[model samples]
Target: MEAMPHDPAKPEFTPLDVPPGGLETPYGILYRPLASGLQILVLFAAFIGGPAFAWVIGQVPGDLSQTARDVLFVPMVAIFFLGYGLWIARLNAIAFHGIGLGLLKALFKLIVFRRKPESVADFIPSRDKLLEMMVRAQQAGSSFAPVGWLVGVIAGLTAMLFDSALHPAKLFLLVGGGCVIWAHLLAWLGRRNWLPFMESE
Candidate 1:
């Protein structure tokens, strides 16, 4: 007897029949390898580009008017922070899933002395499912908590650097206070189980 070739367009078997690395999401085929490479590229670009851009801006000729300089400078600064926010949010998500939550739980147990702190596993459904939750959370805006704080920090630093009238101490204090409030809001959302995107379908 002769054998027939497999046709992916007309899948004859269940999803389990699909091999590893062939998983597809609602968005499209999950190109794990390519995605990983792109993530590395993005991280490298953000970290390296910030200081490089700053240096380039500093080298700008002194002949340009203050208004013209501001036009160029302000947008570059915004771009730097935009990149910083995105990368920071991604890093925070990775840390939260990997070991950050677990470490925080242990630290709380050591300090509170009331009862054994629940494990990260208790809050999270499963390690394997975390990637999906993270993706969804990122889409839903919950994962950008770190981004907001990073932007605040960048804005505060920029103000201090460029505006003599602005008090550096007050700017930093305001940014720090805003970050604290944002952190608490995120914590509250997590406590209420209101992170809709993180919930399993």
Candidate 2:
């Protein structure tokens, strides 16, 4: 028997069917799960006395022993890599799942309607309403952790880079935050856009 066709507007994916390991990417990649966390660590590790470490590194006491210098430098190196790696990985996720897919959806819509645009407007949702939507996505067996682990990393990066290059870390945090937010947004846009890996198509 011949197989039945699929519908694009209403993709086979639904919040209830989101993969247990991670999200479905816009492309065929095995995307990571969407979530956030580790607030207190981010708070103290990145802020508070974090700036002091950079300052200590910057104006090291001329008489201090080489051993003292090594101690300060090691963690800085570790933080530098950890902070940078997470932020970059987060960006890759966003590029593939968020921005890239969003563009694809726009293209799909344009091709379908000749750019006339379909009207799907509604009133702006209140904070509570938005929170409720997140809850709903979770209730449907979808993974939706709203805590960002990058916060502490970004904070650590901020303290370390306060004297040199602050912008990179801040930019990374912004991009990462935007990425997570876009993932949250998928609770609404996922099924509508025929996203890849979402339905095993």
* Highest TM-score against the true fold, candidate: 1
- Overall lDDT per candidate, in order of appearance: 0.45, 0.37
User: Which residue runs does candidate 2 get wrong by more than 4 Å?
Assistant: 1-65, 88-92, 108-116, 120-201
| Residue lDDT tens for model 2, 1-201 | 988886443324334344545444433223233332443343334333323553454343344345433434443334333433443444355444534565566677788977733332122333333334433323222121122233334433443433333355553453344334433333222222211112111
Scored against the true structure, residue 172 in model 2 reaches a CA lDDT of 43
How well is each residue in 106-200 modelled by candidate 1, as lDDT tens digits?
Answer: 67777787555444354344534444544444333333345446655664465445433436676455434444344334433322223222222
Which whole-number lDDT from 0 to 100 does residue 90 have in model 2? 47
Give the Å error, residue 193, model 2. 30
RMSD of each: 13.8, 15.6
List of clashing residue pairs for candidate 1: none
In model 2, the Cα lDDT at residue 86 comes to 40
For candidate 1, give the lDDT: 0.45
